[model samples]
Target: MKNARTFTTFALIALASTATALPFDAIDATQAYQNEVAILEATGAMPSTEPVAIFPAMPEEEVAAPVIASLQDVSLPAQPRVGAPAAVGVATQGREVAAPSADIALPAVDLAALAETHDALAVRKGEDGEADAMMMLSDVLFSFGDDRLEPAAVALLEDLAPELEGATALQIAGHTDAIGDEASNQELGLRRANAVRDWLIANSALSADVVTATGIGEVDPVADNLRADGSDNPEGRALNRRVEFLLPDAG
Candidate 1:
């Protein structure tokens, strides 16, 4: 009886010690990234406390809290894999972007209701006089000088998730400023669009059929021919660098 009890106690102690938490700062970056990605996929947050390696095991509150704080300032998307140069930046397709047919019956996403009071949107009203809501990717979906989604982008997505969920289809378009050559612009634009498309397919809880990506390269312009401040050379050119989110249009 005495021997059995001692053995049981020893086994329990060993088991408890084995399942210790991870150390935050002690973890190397490479390991930390692996740990964070796994945790984000699992717990939905980064920076965990597990020894040696961190298994995807975090509480719901633990995950949701950080997200709230992290997404407060950042208005763009998460930096996982969205746009950028294909070789170095986010994963992108080559030149020649592919757009969905105008006749495709895609799902509808209410861009206005979704962006209600949300400053992270830039909806271009109807070309004609009408109340229209469209998805605006003005510095909200990608990073500056890079095409990848920002780090806090996921949390931002989480905030806008409902809007995204409401949409049945998503049209990802890539645009570029007129500074670069036409060919480079075209290639860069395609890469950016494809990158976003890939990200939506991987992370978004939407169907691929309901989503398509295209790159316009310097064709579309939203703002005046120049920038907001006083700059003659920056008007339409700067305005050209933008992406648009179109709701389901039968036409």
Candidate 2:
């Protein structure tokens, strides 16, 4: 019995020596535990090995992290829509100007020579083109209401012949008093103007093409043909019966 105890003690010492010489990585954990349990059972030990707590390994840290830039550091170009105004930082030279209209016509002006040469003649300005002249007729120039010219009419036209020698345009306009019917007076006035225009072209140096005749009857009157009481005004009637001439611009 004492020899048996000695043999067990020798066996434990040999196993301990073998375990200490071997590497932990070379040994299987399950097989080593089973061996320990067998040894303990065979030796009849009072207690077994206790359980050990195991935990997972910690995650590795990143080597280097990426960097992000701020919004103010980035820049972009501007884009303008079609038909819109120019973008900022752009410069414009000038705006376009419109030309004058072609449809408008300029006014006519008379020659300076015509104005200076005919200063002795009476000149009247009218709204329509050119200048005008009026001549008052006498009772003796024509038999009352008749278109026939008397000896006095011929003498008066002869006196006016020198002043109208080189006139480019001459229009003879006749007027009458309100004593006669409108149609009869219009016809008489026209006939009287025609006689005078024809006489001037034939007897004087004036051209036939430049002279024309027209009659207004009593339509345009310078004086009152009748008094306020509807009575006859002889002087006004006499003033109404007259002839006028118009001379247009030479240039």
Candidate 3:
């Protein structure tokens, strides 16, 4: 009976030892698995549990606005008479008064000579005699697509300045051909008229208050801009591109 009891005690102790050893082995295996997983993560062989950090978006750039040019204010002047008859000396009708004490001799006025001397295309007297006289100047006075007066034009203006010495008022009107847009042509005409006006005021005896500049643009063309077949007419266009000077009689 004593030996049997001792054998039973020994069997129980061995079973407890075996159970404790099995639990230690299982804990070692779990620790090794955790270490391997940590190595894989550090070496970039496995993905991380931490949320991926996002990059901030770049700021957008701002755009700049465009610049625009400012134009000057210009006003139109009085329109000139297109066609008018020349003044002729009237003969005394039904006047038999031959008792005139002394024969009055008047100097004949030569308009053609006056126009040529002033370098003007034509000089026309006003119909009402009280209106302003019109003098037409060709576009040859300025370069193509330019507002500046040529050297020859300056010389011509110098000759013409004498006529404006006693003028009460002067109007400079610029006209352009129909080769460009109306707005551009209008601006060009205004620039041309301003150029002429500036020259006259600076070089001539005319005052700024008495001188006025205007742009007629292509609206007051003296000739056709296009032919019957819709082709361009260089000659007519040249004629249309002109500057007119209107001078009122001296007070």
What is the lDDT, from 0 to 100, of the residue 159 in candidate 1?
67
Q: For each candidate in the order shown, give its overall lDDT on alpha carbons.
A: 0.58, 0.64, 0.66
lDDT of 3 by residue, 1-251 (tens): 45644554474346434644564543454454456446555655545432112112224575567855454444333364566433333347845333343334333323334566644466544556532334455566888889989888888778777666555677888889998899888888889989988998999777899889988888977779999999989988987788877653332
| Model 2 regions more than 4 Å off | 1-132
Off by over 4 Å in 1: 1-108, 131-138, 225-239
Global CA lDDT computed for model 2: 0.64
Candidates 1 and 3 compared: the better one by TM-score is 3
- Angstrom error at residue 217, model 2: 0.5
Candidate 1 lDDT by residue in tens digits, 86-180: 22223347454444444455345566666664565556677675435454453565665467766555555656654575566677777887666
The TM-score that candidate 3 achieves is: 0.50
Those runs of model 3 whose alpha carbons end farther than 4 Å from true positions after fitting are 1-113, 118-120, 124-138, 248-251
